[model samples]
Target: MRGYLAAVAGSEPLTPVSRDWARQRTDLEDEVPVVHEETVTGRRYEGDGIRELRIPRFKSVAGRSGDLTQGEWAETALAAAVLADARPVLSPRWKSQQRLTLGRFTPVTHIRVVEIGCVDASRNVLFEGTPEEAHHRYVRMAEARVRAVKAGGDYLPGQGCGACELVDICPAVPSRPGFLGVDSPPARRRSWSMTTARDYRTCPARAHLKDLFLPRAEAAENTPAIVRGQAVHTAIEELHSRSPVRACASTDAPATPEHWRAGRWEVTGFQARLGTQMVGDHALVCPLHELPGDAQVYPERSLVVHDPDADVVVVAKTDLLYRRTDTWFLRETKTVRSLDESDPLLAYPQLALALLLAHEGAVPGTTEEGTTGCRVELERLTGSGPVLTELDGDDGELLAQARRIVTEHATHWHADEEYVARPGKHCETCPVIQWCPSRPEKSAA
Candidate 1:
């Protein structure tokens, strides 16, 4: 992004004023440095031709710059139309940066608006044309998407519940006062999830830094194993999302599992092959297998519930949520190099949330009477083969164990004010170590 910015800013004397921008000077090939910042409303950019509405992508996730869906194009076009119609204004921040005298900023409408990407500063335009053209595209393509967003219906319990003011009264998120089993009052309203719990247990600073959305080292975060796991999940998810839902076949595994590619995630060699085996294993124990065609399946569904007593929103993203007639089953899938002899719930604490939701009959569509029709399952795809485990949601003993695991994980996190670092081996792959105050310095080799 800095490279692109520097290229466009095109400063004189081949010298960029900002030290951050100067860092990219060596790598920047096209430098048309300009101090003038253009804006429509609050937007800021430099240069001309078709005025651009840049979509900034900071993460090295699987995606392209200009390959947008129709709805996405429509949305971007609508925004571009707004930019085209509005007059430009010089931002106060830019003026301050230039150390210029503040004065009335004139508004001048531009004839065209173009949507572009900031990742590589490429001329890969998603949309470009006149304001009228953009508006017509939006009405024809994106208006329904806009309408659906505004016409909110069912109460969804998810990550947003933590910041939601109506969580106390939300019909979907069942309030489980004293759920975290914490005696002290909360320091502030916060959200809790298996990921947060796991990260906090590993290192509080890791959790805090992640919550702050600090830039991470992509190489460390997207290791081969991690990418392989993601690929396997993506393949399974795509299969589950098929129109007129069909059960995954044993032969459905990728033909080239040794070099599998899912979206932007490409894995090769051993990891890729193992991921393929995992995908195939999933077919042996697919929840949709043998189910009726009308069976409803929600893959990668997020469930949120509020704990008013602890002032935390408990969030869980289940791998699969499917219903067979009256009973609803929540399935959690795992891909492991080898299956070890350990408590499944303890090995993968995320399952605790699924178990608790099932036991409490909290998932949407659970029978009003109780958890009679709710079931929880664990599916492991190991090197040997696939193993399926079912946890009776109505089992009191299992429910107690699940509750204990969740509370144990949430207690310290809820009480923590300073997410102090616990640097150790985990620091080797810690994505946010760059921002950690306690990060250990490397010794001279």
Candidate 2:
């Protein structure tokens, strides 16, 4: 009985269109119509009786690589009339094709964004309006790159892993030996971090050499100031899960022998400045400490999101994340020499990305998500006290600015000829100072 019903369902009449209807998409293939081998196209749907759409078993309605690229959108637009979040049912083309391949289904969490075509209105007429073109500029850039490549410029080292053989000699690549067996030189994909982004803005050559090519400096983490900063950051992080007072009694302690060995400050001095001294209208810690008992904390949460405008992936590891009531928050902690109203860290890119993610509900945080927005906190644990700056919880302006900056940087990231070393204030602290060919000494020569 089951086999008989399955056969009737498989042969049931429904609208069929050429396989190319789902295969070739103009979005990916430079707007060219693609013809496919499968012939079943052009079926008409009539009075609905148990309406269902049949698709290949292995693929998704969202589409994937190769011929199916963007094909899911076709299924999406076609099925938009009535069905939504429709799970495609998999079945063999013929009864004898395979008895084992009877029925399988895959589910999606949410389509994220789906554009359903008009079913009630005229279908034959072309409707020209489009989705919110927030990233249209980046789309144009992608198109331009395609044009550039076809004109004999086949490749360029993007802000990502440049697969070209010339990466070894490329100035955009670092020239230093890595630490141990680990090489952290940035590649074309998953390459742009907050640090690398700053490096690129400050000095492209330094970015190429230190961030891309050279080995990370040995014991860089052991620097006195760095260690102290790490201690403060650790204290702040663990404070979310455990009280600073209770944590000191066990291995959960924030200030450790590591502080004594850090040699940056007398342990007493460090504690006085960090623990006893800092003051503010309401320090970052105050809000953190006041957070409700049930509020969850995510420490050093690493985030990666694609900046479509720049056509690059932007990566960030936030110092801390927390939620209160229903609102989510992201914070960046800094043990700085001083804090001012105009502190550069106030407008930092990492915070911007975090803000954007929180707003988009890209990762878990707020129960309210976009409606409540994410609060961004920048705090400096100074000798004077902790100085804090808060962004409007709902302000998305900073996020937009961050995307623009990254996009602008990415537009020029592929320029191999522009890696000419230049001395700037940034050189004083650059890790790869020895590798720079444009240093004052090298320039004087």
Candidate 3:
């Protein structure tokens, strides 16, 4: 991001010797140097003055790579247009103060902006031109998107809520004085999800590193079981996403199990066969089978709410949310090698969030009786077959159990200021262990 900003803002050009020295340093010993590279082309007409460059960096993950969202495009184009029109020059005195290092102030010049994949070495331009051009493009192609964004009124209290200044008065986030069951006062605002809770339980440093968005070991995250699970989910989601939705069929399972692929996820051999069977099993119990054509179906929709009392933003991602009659259903699907007969909520503590949300009326729909009308279902596609179990979300006993599960998971996490590493055997599978200062090293033995 800094490199892109510097390229746009016209930083001091690197001297040839400095560049070579940096390149040499990067290529230490036998390691290949990943030298930063980019190209900016187009003639700078005389008297064009200074240029303000804007680049909207896009995420570089598999499915998200090489694509700039409509919202992002609209924002960048509108910003460039506004900057080109205003062209306000900051005072030199302000720039001179090192305490406030915004940047060196420069006089106005023609503005140019471009959008690119954040990690694309080719830097293939998505949109690039003068600020006036950007404005025209926005007006012609992107104005409606910008307008729609402005018109959006719903507050989605998520991880970002921790950073939101208006959270104190935000009506969406409920203030439950003892929500997380933590007696210790919050050290600072933070976000807590089941994933965070689980990671913290495994190793505090792993959770903290993930919070900081540190680079992770791809191998650790892409284990065969994980990849198979993702592939199964992608396959199931595609079926649910079809227009004029219909019940999933056995034939919908992967035709070529040897090399089955869905979106950016791929699987083969035993994992592929297992995923195929899971998809087939899901076909037998698809929620849409009994629903009317117009039934609302939301797959992998995120449910975010804030607990101001705990100073935490709670986030849960439901596998499937569907409405039938007056009742809403939150279904959590798990692809497992075998079925377990243990208590589902206790076995999968992640379900506690869904259980609580359903009971608290956080989900959209409700029963005709004017009560929270969410039926929490667990769909386990196991090696044997598909199993569907419904938990009575409105039951007081069940709700209490769910609360205990969440509180147990969240209490220690919410109170900790120093997320110190508790290294152990779990470190072998920690994704961000590469960045852990106290990571265990293999013994020479």
Q: Considering every candidate listed, which one attains the maximal lDDT?
A: 1
Cand. 3 TM to true fold: 0.73
Candidate 2 colliding pairs, count: 16
Model 1 — TM-score against the truth?
0.69
lDDT of each: 0.71, 0.44, 0.69
lDDT tens digits by residue: candidate 3, 43-154 = 2211235343334343333344246576766655565554444322223432322222122323344554444334332233344466567568768766677457645777
Q: Give TM-scores for every candidate, taking all chains together and pairing residue i with residue i.
A: 0.69, 0.45, 0.73
Instruction: Give per-residue CA lDDT, model 2, range 1-445, as digits (tens).
Output: 2322232253435444222111111232456753321112222222233323332221122322234334343333433321222222244443322322212222322111221122111112111112222124224333444344435642323434422334444443332221011222333433556576566767778767865455444353255556556555555455444633221222333333423322233344555345323322123355555555455676677654443323234456787766666666787776666665563334565665555555554444353434364677877667666666786645456655644554444445443435666677766666777567787774554
How much is the lDDT of residue 346 in candidate 1? Answer: 92
Report the lDDT tens digits of candidate 1 across residue range 352-407: 77988776667887865543477889988888899999988778898899999998
Ranking by lDDT: 1, 3, 2
Model 2 whole-model lDDT (C-alpha atoms): 0.44
Candidates ranked by TM-score: 3, 1, 2
Weakest 10 consecutive residues of candidate 3 by summed lDDT: 16-25
For model 1, the run of ten residues with the poorest summed lDDT:
16-25
RMSD of 1: 10.8
